[model samples]
Target: METLYRKYRPKRFSEIVGQKHVKTLFINSIKNNNVSHAYIFAGPRGTGKTTIARILSKSLNCENRKDAEPCNVCNSCISIDKGNFMDVLEIDAASNRGIDEIRKIRETVGYHTAQGKYKVYIIDEAHMLTREAFNALLKTLEEPPSNVVFILATTNPEKIPQTIISRCQVIDFKNIPLKDIVDRLEFVCQKEKFNATKDALIEIAKRANGGLRDALTILEQVAKSSKNNIDINDVRNTLGLVSEELIDNLLKNIKEGNIINILKIIDEVYYSGRDFETFLFQTIEKILLLIEENNNTEFINLLKPLSDILKDIKYSEEKIILVKLGFLNLINFKENNNKTTNKVLENIKKESEKIEENIESEKTEVMEKDIPKFDEVLEDLKINGDLSLYIGLSFAKIQEGSDKIKLIFPYSKKLHFELIKDKKSFLEQYIKRKFGITKEIEVILSNSTEDETLKKLSFLFGKNYKIEGD
Candidate 1:
């Protein structure tokens, strides 16, 4: 059976979705009998760049086309739809990205169309063209033959040469919106005679991330996998995405500051063999909704770290642990922030007491660097919703100071130290919250350099290794 994406591909302009502007331009050009010789269609994949190009090709060549719409029954339209048209050439630039392939086009530029007035060349993945290949095509694009029209379609328009882009009219295609995708899925389900729930289609639409072709492909897969009525669970299972209930529970737990509940959800996600990246994204989407409703930055802050974790999920062995750590970091952030608020109030009381107490007495408490507080400060940082800072501070060592909290790191840890150091003011505020007294915050690289052998040993054995000579 043909794939739904190909089987139900948009053959006409009216069938395309979410890019009314591009369609408007094409319709107007067709009405005026004026079409550009060279054009570039740029946007995300499955947004119908090549599909629109084919429709244009069919309309321009259609013997009985009206108002830029092709008659499906006509020989020209049927041949073009089947990819056997003599005048319409579809080139995959990815495989044939060298100058030699483009040379074929340069050689054929002057020839009259075999079957139609306009010969359309639709080059997909145009961005993959080699720099030399683009150089070869530059002249052809700038001054193409009168009868030929070039439609360059690319997901990445930036890679295409400026000179090539300058000569061609550029039309950007947008990813079809979720509602449109859901509607399209419904249409597909009705035509295929498959039983589908609205929620199922919605889930597929959400999973597609604005790609209508992706949505149809998913729907087709789900329909094949489930012989019975297709529902949201089947869609969820097929996509390995968390359900709405789980997402709701996650946000509720996060808002209530229930770390245990949040961890439980994370554990459920892991045990269910769910895609952590997808789960993370779903969770973040819920968080964003909460932020929109409640205007909470706390949840908003988690997005950055979660996004970073998603980037690294493929590279890490323990992705579940990374996600757990991310949320734990958020929990720690909320806990430490609440602690900071209380400590600031306590610090005010302490300050007033210092005014009444002797200077030496104040020094005994305020000036004394509590070693345990350094761990607390780092813990607070780890939990404080700043994943980058948490990752950075993980590399530094806390040092003793009578009048200041000193953070020392080996030269190798300079990057981490710098990351934490960038948030010096926030660190000071955290210190004041934890210790009820603000101390000078100092970050410095170690003055003593370890021998190369010792450094290697330390790296291999971790920081627990004891140096006999040192």
Candidate 2:
């Protein structure tokens, strides 16, 4: 069965939804008898480069054409529409991009048209042509036969040599607007007799990313999948899209400085089989919208770093880990608007070092204290057959300061803290045995300790990152 995009493709300039500028130029040129022998159409894929090329061929060869519009009823128009026109040759440059093919085109360029007034050659993916192939076709393009027209279409115009580009009329295609794509989808639904909600169509359009053909194709898939009526939920399920509700919850968490919930949500989204890159992009999109409404500089500050990380996520072998790190970095960003979160930390570290230097230079008195040690606890656990507790506390650090003892763990050992924090008496008993005091005990994450831990994690996981939380 033909796809909706292929079946409903624009047959004339009037039917094209966008690119009014390109249409106007072609119409004026045809009306003025100023049609060029060679033309180049450059744009992103699914934006109607090849379609426009075919339309131009039909209009030029139509028995009846008005204002550069092809008469659909004419024999030339029908043949071109069906892709069976003898004088209209459609070549896939990706498949035939060698010097031999260009030579064959050169050989055939002098021959008169078999059926139409002017023979048209439409080369798709024109950027795929080899340098040698382009060199071979250069002479023909410089001074071609009057009875032939060449239409070169490509998504990446930068790949084409400047010399080849200089001899052709270049037209750039723009991405269709979201509203335009939605309207087109609605039109397709009415023609196909499919029931679709407005929001459902809008969601499809958003997923299409300003491609009309993609929107129509998604509409067809959703129509078939629904087997009754299409709704927003149907589109979400088909695309595995994270809901706006979920994104809002994420925003709320970030605003409230809830790092644990943010990390948990990332894990849930990753485990649910959502596309991580798409999730990051949609997350960035949602953040931008929130920044606009609330005028929050924090979100604005976090946006660029997250976007930069999102680009790097595509190359990651372990996407889930990178996603977790990316979110953590955002959560860890400080409230200071003057500097990025990382820079603030660097300044704080430098200040601390300066303070230490001053203390050393002044010969300040230092207090001595017995630090409650973890090695003794590990030995105790090993002696008592408590391997689970020993293993859990292996990565934890015990620091003793004036009037208090704190057990600090790296963020990566969150499960370990959960296990041992509940056994407060067990940890305190060891503290008393080592220090002979009942000082208050606190368990938490150490920023300085985590800095070192994250360095090791970077070595193990391929990226360095930090999150702020206890």
Candidate 3:
């Protein structure tokens, strides 16, 4: 019996799945009667390279082609579909990649068509052709036969010589979009009257990773294994993949610092024979989505630890231990950050009070009239949702100048200075909001040898008060 992918392979341009761009080029070319002599179809596996090549062959020789689509009922289309067409030839370059094969093709392209308007050579896996064979075919590709069409399809276009590439119109076939793959699977199920949950179809599509043909193959395998009532659980069981729900639970516990639940989940995954790398990768992907799309920094602390764990996996066979250590590092880092924030907040509060006290006692003309207190800057950062920036800025001191407000970072904190320098516009905006006009702010890395910086910062509080903290 024929497989589902082969049985439902696109017979016409309209039935070809994704890659709107590729379809447009051929459609426009056919409409204007200006088809090229040689074309290169390049991209990933199972992504409609050979499929589109065959469709283009059929369209070129199609007796009643309309709007770049072959009339499937015509004798020319039928012979091409049956692989019996005299003028349309499909060669598997992987097997026939030699000078002999190129010699035959060079001889064949020079002849007149036996039955069709043009002779089409569809070469699948064109990259596998030997270098000498490519050199022999280069002249034919360069000075294309007026009546011949050469379609070179390959998964790796880089292997094909540039001389061959420059002679052809290169059309890249991309991975079919997930939604399109699912829609195609749904249509297949509806046609076959096979029952499947939408979640099951989606899971199949995700695992296919943008390959429509591979998605159909997976769907067919699952359908064969099931009693026509396939659901999400059926997919998980058959594919031996980690459960999405279980991964979510693991992430939730990690974020809440629930070390016990995290251990249970890790143990369950390890003992049940699921892949640790797969589970880790899926969990990391979920966290990345949260950070990128939602801007949720709850698990941002784990990125470094998780990255280290991933690197450690390559060197050590003790993956489970490394994974556990990585998760433990997450909570430890989170708690340490909380401690650091508390310490910084405490020091800022104390410093603000002391500066206010000295201002009332001595009536300092500089700080009381010019810039905001340090605590006020920290408060604005907290209220405005710039946690990482706030933390980066916490290491530095704000220096009020006659022409500019300089953010001074001690030489030891040059990394923080570099990180915070990207937000120069935001700091300038803060200065403008506080002082009623825009002011330039410069990030200055102070010399570490310059007497500890505690004395140089006396302009903020008073000549008597010299404050510093890491």
Candidate 4:
């Protein structure tokens, strides 16, 4: 059976949706009698480039057409719509992309139209044309016979040479919007007398990702599977799409650090016949959105380890990891039921909580520490290092100090201490070398006391060291 999308593919320029700019240009060109000999239509697949090309050919040859619009009732229009138009030659450049093909086309270009006013050559996937083929066609494209019109279509315009592109009027087609796809699908459902919910149509449109052909294909699949009233759930099941609720549940489990629940959800999704690669992609997309929202950086950080798992495009490997590690913990509910999984999950959750607690406790301890004032420490160091180089190390303090000199470090106590310990002796020697005198250096760790450091830093490095508080 012909799918709804194919069955209802636009037959005329007016029927093509969401490409007003291209349509307007073509219509105006025909009206103004300024039509180019060749045109290059490029964009994503199923964006109606080929359809528009055929329609334009019909309009050019139609017995009756308004401006550039094809009169669908005319023999020329009907033949073109049915792909039987003699003067409208459609070539699949992917299969016929060689110098020989170009020679054949060049030979045909010299001949007048057999049955139409202008002979039209439509080369789909024009980017596939070899360099020789493109070069051979360049002269004809630039100065084709008055009776010949060339329409070149490609998904990737970047592959086509600038020389070829310069000879043709380029029209870029954009992906059809989701709302437009849904509206069209709904219209198709009405025409076919099939009950379809808005939600179902929207789901199909989203899965189609702005491709009208794919959306219609999915819609046709669902229509065949469903007897009446296509619901969102029906669309999900028919398309094997993981449910948003399920995705939400998985995200919640990951956010709560419930590894067991996460595993269980993975198992459930797998058992429900969802592709693991799809799941991984969906998970990655969801995580990216969460990261954008700034609501779950910690969860994002935790999932960073799974980057390798997401890197593989093969489904089998993804399925293995998702089924074994992600879902295995959730599936053992029958033995210990939810109890065992919950216990393990809870344990992991507690460990994460404990780690967070430890971090907080450390922070509090640092805050309570009796660290030296920033001005005093800055005076002791005397701005020895280039301030610009060390400016990013904003939060510095002293771990240990004396009246003669002070030890300087970063706010992150460990890094600060480590850096001081590593560079202390070298820095001291370097300073002494620069000053031509021995200098006593004290090492101090910088905790979260950034304001004090900034005040003293401004004194040593001038107003340029004025630090902004977060």
Candidate 5:
């Protein structure tokens, strides 16, 4: 069966959605009988460049037409629609993009149409054609061939030579509007008898990102998987889309420096079968919005790590690792730059003599507890035959807290930290069994040693990151 994009493709000029500007120009050109012999249709993909080209081909040759529109009943329109018309030829310039192919067209430019007055040539992805081929085609486009009409469609018009561009009527096509895309999806739902909710169709349209063809393709995939019944959940499941709610919550957590919730959300997104790149891309766009409104430096810092994850995404099979690590980097950047939290910590630290005296008294007693030290955990990992985990965590500096074991790593030990963090459960289990400490295991990245600022950093951030004081 033909896909929805093919099956529901616009068969007439009036039926095409969006590109009112292109349609308006072409209508006046055709009505005036002054259509250019050579034309360029430049736009993004799925924006109906090729569709309009074919429709225009029909209008140029239709035996019976009404106001620059094809009648669709004539032998000309039927044969063109069925892809058997001799006068209408579509060339995929990506594959046949050389001088030899251009020479072939140059040879046949003057031949009489088999059954129509105009012989139309549509070159799709015309930008992929070699410079030599474009130069060769320029010769033909420059003169003669009164019965021939050439339409070149490309996503990249800037690559075409300026001399060639000067010889053609360039009709730039914009992306279809969101409302138009949704309305079309609704029409498809009605005609195809697909029981899709309005919100579901809107979700599909948004996912399509202003491409009507992409919207219909997504709708059909969800429709087929749903047997023509689609809802928001079906669209989410079919497209593996992270919900807007989750995406919003994630950015909120990043801004607030909520490490635990951020990790939890990453788990939710990963288990929902969402693609890592999609999830990261959505978050980056939202962060960009936040940075734009607030002009906040911390939010801007989050983008570098998020973008780094996008590049690193292809290097690993388990994407959850990169996502979790990237967000951890975000949390670190956020918390370390939190002026409000650090200010409170500074005031508290100023009067620390009393608290320090109190803490010093309890510190002795707390130290007597069976809390695990970082070295003992490493020793336990080694003894338990986890040599890789033992070796990976071996480089971390030890900081034993009253109720936790803190492991610190430098920037150079990032891979080691990631490896150890990935196996936190196993390491936690080993420490609990061997050391009798029910304490949580915390991992962090920092370049500072045990000092006053490090302690403030610990207070500002969550348990995932810890910095100690002497």
Candidate 6:
């Protein structure tokens, strides 16, 4: 039985999935009658390079083509689909990569298309052509007969000679997007009368990893494996892949610093035939995500120990000495009945607590000492010489024996409050460095009477001054 991907292979340019930019270029070339004599389509396999080449061939030969698209009703289109078209030749270079093959192709250049205006040569896996074969074809490619066109397709274009590349116009095809793959798979399911869930289709698509052929192959395998509607479990079981839930649980155990639990989960997975390397890779990925959440520093710190443990499990031996050390530690772990692991974990917890406490103590000290004897802070501001600028600058009112310091600025409205909020860190850092203190500073906006403002300013600047009430 034909597989879904092969059965539903795109029959025309419009049916080709992804490669929109390449499609546009092809369409415009056909529209403008500016087709190149030789072309190279290069990218990953199953990205529809050969399909597009065939479509372009049909469009060029069709008796009635519309906007460079093949008119499927035409005899040319039908014959091309059946691989019986004399005008369009599809050669598998992998099987015919000798100089003799190139010689045969060169010999055929004299004859024009039997039923069409041009003869098209589509060489699949053109990179497989031998060096001598490529050399034999280069001259023909450089100045091909007016009625002949060449379309060379390869997944590994780099293997082809640069001289050959320079002789042709290149179009790079890309891997199909996940959504496009899912949409196409859904269409296949509908056409085949097979029951499939959206999630099941998505899983198949993801497993394909941007290859439509792989996606279809997986879909076919799943359809045969299941009697009814395809479910997530069926897909997982069929693929022999681990569940996301298992991955999540493994991560949770690691994050909780439960080394025994993590090792148990690993053992379960390993014994169940899950790939240990894949588990390690997934754990690394989860740790990276945890690190990305900058607002949760505690979570980041917790994940660091897990990442360290993973790093110790040597998967390779270019660093064999380190791996030996890690294995020795693991062996010793078994002998000690996890006592060492428990002690290490306890130390980690104590370190985390110490870090938190240090932060709190620093905040307290900043609050206590950051508010200078109002006079000294005011003198520094004046020496820096900006009375007008300082007029609206906010000042945090410090209360004796309190951890909080509140800012007071009357001349400015809420703008000062907003600025203070935004610059709170900068202000705190500046105060700590300037005053050698470690306490939290809080900003508060308040309107004081004129007499109060003047008296405060005089006290702050250490100058005798009288204030008249407004």
For each candidate in turn, the TM-score is 0.71, 0.70, 0.70, 0.67, 0.69, 0.63
Please list the residue runs of candidate 2 whose C-alpha ends up more than 4 Å from where it truly belongs after superposition: 335-470
Provide the lowest-lDDT 10-residue window in model 3.
361-370
Per-residue error for 202 in candidate 4, Å, reads: 0.7
Q: Stretches of candidate 3 above 4 Å error?
A: 94-100, 301-322, 325-350, 363-470
lDDT score, candidate 4 = 0.75
Clash count per candidate:
3, 0, 0, 16, 0, 12
Is candidate 3 or 4 superior in TM-score?
3
Per-residue accuracy of model 4 over 225-321 as CA lDDT, tens digit each: 9886799999978877787788888767655557777767767877888877677666776777787887766446435434555554354545566
Per-model C-alpha lDDT, please? 0.83, 0.81, 0.82, 0.75, 0.83, 0.74
The count of backbone overlaps in candidate 3 is 0
Error of 5 at 103 (Å): 1.3
Provide the lDDT at 231 for model 6.
Answer: 89
Top TM-score prediction, candidate number: 1
> For candidate 5, what is the TM-score?
0.69
Point out the higher-scoring one by TM-score: 2 or 3.
3
lDDT of 5 at 282: 76
Per residue, candidate 2 scores C-alpha lDDT tens digits across 29-114 of: 88897899999999877888989889889888999888788888988899998889999999999999999998988999899888
User: How far in Å is the alpha carbon of 166 misplaced in model 5?
Assistant: 2.0
Evaluated against the true structure, the overall lDDT of model 3 is 0.82
Q: Which stretches of candidate 5 lie over 4 Å from their true place?
A: 285-304, 314-318, 339-470
| lDDT value, candidate 2, whole model | 0.81
- Model 4 scores worst on lDDT over the 10 consecutive residues at 389-398
Q: Candidate 6: RMSD over Cα atoms?
A: 14.7
**What are the per-residue Cα lDDT tens digits for candidate 3 across 1-470?**
99999999999878889999998888899889899999999998888988888888888888898889999989999998889999988889999999999999888788888999889889999999999999999998888678899999999999999899999999998988889999999999999888999999999998898898889888888888897778988887777778878988987887677999998998998898877776777777778988999999877766677777777776788889988887788778887888899998887787677656644543342224335654566677878758877877766667766667677776656788898898989877875787565667788888764332442355334567634667
